[model samples]
Target: MNQKQSISYVISSQSSSQQKNYRTKLTAVLNCTRLLLMQELSSRGHDESKESLNKENLIELLNWYVARRKKINEVLFSNAPRNDQMTSPSIHKDLVHCCAVETTRSMINEMGDSLFSILVNESRDNSIKEQMTVVLRFVDKSGHVKERLLGIFHIADTCAQSLKDAIDAMFPTHGLSIFGLRGQGYDEVSNMSGYHSEILERLNIEELSGRTGQF
Candidate 1:
């Protein structure tokens, strides 16, 4: 029988007073754990018996599961070099960073005396990692609208200063200066772009004061 059918048969026959060897009983426990690890699936059939199974079928299913899992683990770890096993993501990121830095640098080189609009946004991709996407939008020297991702940086926190620092680190490398910044735009995020966002306040205030020779 296939894995699914064998599993169902084992569950259904659990309450039967059939003869069960030690292996069958252990397989029942492991199978129940695997099913219930689904949370929703495990919550069902709680009142059902869990100890009886056909000894041979239970052993067969257990072996099938083990063999399949072993092959997967082997494929994932066996051919991968030690450094690549853990650092693949970092290497990909380094390559992307190089490409983005080059792209933004070239765009700036063509920008000349033209001013541009900067768009800022944040996204939470993983449970723990918050990333900021920086983009530049403008009509270039050729008079065509152009937009490009400058970079995506990890922001340790969503607070205003953390956001500012992330972009600050990228600006000089890409030939951007606040004095040449024409406009800044971001959504209504409380700390960075909201009605009273601190970064917005800092940048807007600078724009206003420069005209009056003030802060």
Candidate 2:
């Protein structure tokens, strides 16, 4: 399905379940509305009205709905966990992240190779050790834009040959092809940019000899 239809389906599925409790139903509605609002806001870029889509307004709506829904639940179950300690955990961040990841995967699937580029970069996160991030930029057959984070690959070593081997494995696993690769981008790394022969050089030699490139 197209993006619009897909987003609608995602929202609809959450609220269409008949087995959900009233509180759960309201929560699903709030989650779906937030996702829809965020999608619209993002598509409009910086031009969207902040006043209308303010986070506070969204939170207030959700809170109001939850309160009303809780009252209804209480009438249905006079003695069913009325204590404050029985409150369900808030899952806003986790739910939003899950939706975002799924949306990205869908976009990538729609973008069936219109020439792409690979960018590899390593950075230290909270653990203070290097981790490699692999990103792909491409366009879909329908001329739609798409960008995907393949994943953060752990750097076993900063060696170029090792990185290249990891990349080769990733590409095949993802059903992506080096044939669609228009360019390879990297900042100067000690091993990849070293004087000693790297993966690029090895591949070049093989290409020159009309043989298949090896990682």
Candidate 3:
């Protein structure tokens, strides 16, 4: 059987308590290593600790500390006022935006002076809002090709010009310039294909040779 099948079979054969015990033991091993590293750092005067440095004692302390913190957090969250909690819709949206910004920054850093092409498409979201999705394709410093979704932008319409304007507006926020584009791709639809020449003329993207095709 395959590795996944083997793992599934093993998990299915084990009782719930057995699985729990196995996970607890695995966690303890990791915690034990962390505690040992902390003790080593303390010995080097990089940190200070008053707890016993014995292996078993350190493992027990870490297990207790983790369990206590988990319990405390659960209790606090259960009792805290809903408005004071961090699980609000706005908070989640902010967190997601932050993650997207950081991820895009990292991707750009990886691309680092390399020419990149963009793939663009327009579609209606579940809410029937017209949105344009942009993706970047490039070779990294190590010569591996990478493709990353740049962003999805809400547009006023699905016309070629509207889609092109939306993409243009997004570039400045990400510190990108139209001159850096080496190629462009769009869905082979009537709305996009019919205006290919117009888009090429308006954007002055000479690299695309007045045509749009898949990357």
Candidate 4:
């Protein structure tokens, strides 16, 4: 059988007696923990620790879960180098991040060397550190308006220079060139895009320099 068919057969052949394997139990525990974490994060609007959850009777139930869930993360992480192996709900989360990055890169590539604009924004967590995200607005190869989400970035500070550096680091790695960028959309932060902001002006100048070098 092919690899996919082999997996299907293995799954279809699982009898009740074979369901008690450590790997099987580990999978169930991981699924339960994931569901609980999602519910907790949704209800609390942030990440919660086992310590914070220990006050509840549910903690006892989850502790039983923990007993069975041991070593799964280590096994999971050892499986591969993709972001999924390092993250819970690994396959799904990695696919989401990958889609966001790939869709944006594809849109930019279809822009056909025209002037386009990018928007940047930041979201903050409980620790109050800002994480930046970028979006590109462009027309795709089929002449349809498409907006694609770029990847989230780490903003070490709210300063303009830091934002520019982050952009610099992200641009080349995605096969994106800033040569034809015509405008920038930023939040109402004065330091980011104000008239006298050296960082913002420097980005525009960088785009111009890239354009000049293309000719």
Best by TM-score: 3
Best candidate according to lDDT: 3
**Model 3 accuracy (lDDT, Cα):** 0.64
**Which structure is stronger by TM-score: 1 or 3?**
3
Count clashes in each candidate, considering only residues at least 3 apart in sequence or on different chains. Answer: 1, 0, 0, 0
Q: Provide the overall lDDT of each model, using Cα atoms, as 2-decimal numbers.
A: 0.58, 0.57, 0.64, 0.59
Model 1: ten consecutive residues of lowest lDDT? 40-49
Clashing pairs in 4: none
Q: How would you encode candidate 2's per-residue C-alpha lDDT over 97-161 as one tens digit per residue?
A: 56656755675687665667777887778987667888887777767656677788776766677
Q: After superposition, how far is residue 215 of candidate 2 from its true place, in Å?
A: 14
Evaluate residue 169 in candidate 2 and report its C-alpha lDDT on the 0 to 100 scale.
77
Rate residue 105 of model 4 by lDDT: 65
Q: What is the lDDT of residue 169 in candidate 4?
A: 86
lDDT of 1: 0.58
lDDT tens string, model 1, 1-215? 47656867766665543223223433443453344333433122223223534323323344345466643233233333454332133543454445455656787877766666678899898676899888887788679988877778888988888887886786676777666666667786777664555675654445554542422
Tens digits of per-residue lDDT, candidate 4, 1-215, equal 47656967867787764444436444644454456544653212233354464434223443455466664433433333344232344543553455456656666667766556678887786788788888877666677776677777878886778888888887787666776565677887776665557665656665475454421
Which clashing pairs does model 2 show?
A: none
Model 1 misplaced regions, further than 4 Å: 1-97, 203-215
